[model samples]
Target: MRFGPETWSYASLERVSGQLAGALRSRGVQNGHRIGLFMTNCPAWLAWFFAISRVGGVAVPMNPAYTGTEISSILEVSDLRVLICEDRLASRLDSPPKQPPSVDVLMTSRTLQVNGPAEMIEHAASPDPTAPAVIFFSSGSTGMPKGIVHSGRNLVRIVQTVSMTWPLRSADGLFVAMPLAFVYSSIVECLTAIRVGATVELQERFDPDATVARLAAGKITSMMGVPSMYRMLLATREQPGESGKLRFCATAGETLEPALSHQFGERFSCPLLDFYGLTEAPHIIAHSNPAEILERPLSCGRVLTGVEARVVDDHGQSLPSGETGELVVRAPWMFDGYFRDPTATKAVLKEGWFWTGDLARQDAEEYVYIVERKKELIKRSGFNVFPAEVERVIREVPGIAEVAVVGVADTFLGERVKAWIVPRPGVAVNVEQVLAACRAKLASYKVPDAVEELQELPKGPTGKIARKELRH
Candidate 1:
């Protein structure tokens, strides 16, 4: 694994992971115990994840950017036994109402130390394939996010499916800029590269200039990022670097506009393929073939071999090809369920299919084209920004009578969070004040980029706010 200015050979990573596992065992970590990983994208993050999995502990990856309130909710729901967090992120847990699980703050400067033995410790085999292995939080439309659990078998199956579909060669170098906490980055950029024995170039965060320089230096062969990252790269006015070696760039987490895709291809002289999936199924559901992008620019391409996708109506009846409807999918491997939330899990997972809250259409050739989101979830810069979650935070601000959050189109970010507020009578609400309050409570991406003050927001006959009308 190669992170800017530092490279860890496979052997070195294995040794560190083993030592970390030994340390975890000595600290009394047991099989099935949840271990929270709250850190940025770094070598230590990966090492701790492997160590936890090696000791049969379920890994719960927490977004390092989450605020104290957000992190507290996850800790309460997950009931983690141990938390391995970077020193910088540990401050977020300083004032939890209830004391959180035992935390082991880690620094990059120190190597993992083992007291008794540094020898490799084999993991106990899980008797059931469905046993929980990892927990991921999905933005909730109602309010708080739900924890999606995946099994050990699900991880192996997703890696295998991705390796077969993309088929990266050992000589290739993969560049990853997306957050590792996101399932897309973890599966496509990390595990897939490891499976193919390809070198991974990790970036702690996306920087357009640094990314372009690496590509120009011919240090990376393939790159994976979200639509926003690609837009940033296209926005740069600098001369295109030595990009001839870049084979292709894959994008997901939000819709990839055909115009943006065209502009990126024209600028970089490489195919900008669209990838589509969700946290429920971490593996790519559909991906555009690099060679066929010109012919099928709008499509997300064919579904993977082991995956079944269909456009269905509200009744779960399959819609014919070329018709827009909800996209339902059944894959060989998928998330087990929403942790401790059988009600929510049952709502989406029916029989053998998972009903994705995405409106899409399918061509006769089985290529999927996303239309719009059926849910009220806002995706800004590849991160989920739940309107309700933001509203809950913003509603507490003084002089705020009511607030409604929606996603507005953006050239660079695909969609940015926008809030419409109706202030209380005789009180003045400033946009900057509302934003300042949100910045303290919500993640950076969830903060509203624009705020509008209205005497009264548009409402439907039922007296509920009409989000669709506000969107227009």
Candidate 2:
């Protein structure tokens, strides 16, 4: 289960990480020290992760898609002692903090170029399951990021649960284009492959043609991505090559549109399974297989073997199966609460149940369907409007590739519905035309006050819509 750049095999990665661990030990990156990884999808990112784990230090993976200011905030909050970044992106960072003396900043190019003192890169073999493995940020608070801390055993539980649910094996080669910063893809696609002894194909970033080429070139058996990634992949011109290698395709990080899933699965001749998970309660909560989609298309699938899921109202009372409420999850592998933020942690983690702010409902058979985000609910003219419900109807209209519904400040109404859309390829979307379509499907009050077409919506590293950023 060795991995890194194609040229530097698994053995080389082990040697480099072992050498880097020794280097960090020499430079005073001791056990329990937090090390920040500020780089995009690359071998070095994974290299630093394993290296930190070797020395029992916590690896903090920052979104490489972040600007300098955003990255600086995480560095300060996590109290990072050592920062590892790609040399090319060094200029993105601003001046050093005035208070701290000076933190050690190392580059990947420097690490690979220099001759190391040790050569056990293939596998250093430090199996301390209790050590803190990594920390990721979840967008729970309005603008602030909540750090999610996960232990090695916690991560192992996640990986084991997903692999068992999907039933991936050694012969399966996984292709992951999502940012390593996100927990879902990082854990399921990257670490799970390593833990299960599967070959992983690494890409620096996702490109439609490049992604298609890799899927065709490599023995790619499975892929895990967000819904948007699948949309972009569908736009690529089909190549006459082997497609049977692609056995399973899973989508997460956001709700998957039924329209998109049907279209994508038909094109690839592979079933696109829909999965549901969150950063707080990180496990495969529900899955929609091809057969399940036929009977219950909207169901996110029945609960997993060990996971306890339910819907509860504001008063913490469990709702009936057919009623929609805040989706709460209680799993053995759930996260250990937010880091250094007890008040925020206590708010969500109550009575062994994680109050996932996501709105959902369960069927009589225990199937779940996410409706919308509780925070994303909007009030316009004293009427409640759930963005996902509006967007779901709008997406049903032909020629609409993507749509995001937001409540914009209005003079007349307290807040009016504003829809941002990305049109399908080669089709010109008219505002009046879309409004007419919405008028047919939705009530007058639910219709968008304005429809603005964009080339693409702003997406965070994990591929979720950066709704907060869109406020400006």
Candidate 3:
């Protein structure tokens, strides 16, 4: 793993993780211990992660940006035995019943800092593939994220699934600016690349300027990011030089707007393939390659080799091609249900299939097109409104950087359509102009009843627009 001027080799990874594992064992970390990893993206994050799982522990990777409230909630439900984070972020965990962790906090720098013998794992065998390996939380774009559990087997299945999408070679370098806390970054991005012995470029956080400059330097063959990151990357005037070896950029955290996808293609001269997955599924249940994304444009590509997907009605009957319904998926890498939340787990999972609360449709060729979250649909004057349909149209309007359509409460109608938009840095957006744009392409009830422009929109840990935040 390379971060800026410093690069950590596979030997360094083994050594550092060994030393960290020794520290874990000394701190009473045993098999199946649930440990919280609260930090941003870094090479050492992998060190501690490998260390936790090396000692037969369950790694709980937490977003450093999570509020004290969210942290408190995780502490209450995750049954976390230990929380390891940088010393700088220890302050944020000071909440709820005077701290919920039984084990002491372990703090380290963003770089490898463990000091101990490397023999801890020198002769040890590979970790169990089916043993609990990780507990990942939802992105909470709509509400509080849920804790989803997975084993090493689940992680490997998705890695194998994504590997078939990217034509990665061992000599190739993959750039990862997304945070390690997100499941996409861990399995789809890093593990998939590492499976072929590819090198990784890590970033502590996504900085548009830094990433653009890194791409211009030309060692990267591929990269992974979300739609929001792509928007900010395009907004920067720093176009990558011709030395660019970038083959294609993959995104999965959020829906990729068609306009944003085209802008990325025109700017970088590479395909911006959008993949789709859920925390419950770990990563990459369905994906697109360069040819498919260009040909189909709006489709989320075909389901992976070992996954099964269906759009079903409210009564749980599967819908036929081109029909809109809730998407339910079953994957070889499906999560081990939500941690300690049987009620919530039962609500989504039924008879081995995970009920994804997404309103989507399928093409005759079996491609998926997610329209909106089941809860995000707006009902105005007896009409159904999918937010993605409205947002896609609004996003195509000139001078709009990003847009999020939400359903707000109404007295007469059950709900009213509302839109929150962010214009280009220097452009000024007014309600009348936005309404005019929506009016041209939408039905009277489909148009936003209200429009408000902001400097920026609130985002969840995964960089998706936080519609719940926009509702208020």
**Model number with the top TM-score:** 1
Model 3 regions lying over 4 Å from their true place: 95-97, 114-119, 123-128, 139-145, 239-243, 284-288, 376-472
Worst 10 residues of 1 by lDDT: 107-116
- Best-first order by TM-score: 1, 3, 2
In Å, residue 200's CA in model 3 sits off its true spot by: 0.9
Q: Flag regions of model 2 displaced more than 4 Å.
A: 1-8, 95-102, 110-115, 119-131, 377-472
Off by over 4 Å in 1: 95-127, 239-241
Model 3 residue 419 CA deviation in Å:
12
- Per-residue CA lDDT of candidate 2, range 379-421, in tens? 5543446677678767877899998988775533446789999
* Candidate 3 lDDT, 366-459, residue by residue in tens: 9899877676756553344677767876887889999999888654354679998999989876778778766655545678988888889999
Q: Candidates' TM-scores?
A: 0.95, 0.77, 0.78
Compared with the true structure, the alpha-carbon lDDT of candidate 3 equals 0.77
Per lDDT, the best of the predicted structures is: 1
Per-residue lDDT of candidate 1, residues 1-472 (tens digit): 8887678877777677877777777778888888888888877777787888888899899887888888888877888888777776657778445335455444332233323254666664343667888898766777786998988889889888877777477888899877788877786578889888999888888988888888788788888788888889877765546556778678787766778887777777777777788889765455747655667776777788888988999999999999999999999787888999999999999998999899999888888888889998888888888899999888999999999999998878878889999999999988898999899878898999999999999999999999997786
Per-candidate Cα RMSD to the true structure, in Å, reads 2.2, 11.1, 10.9
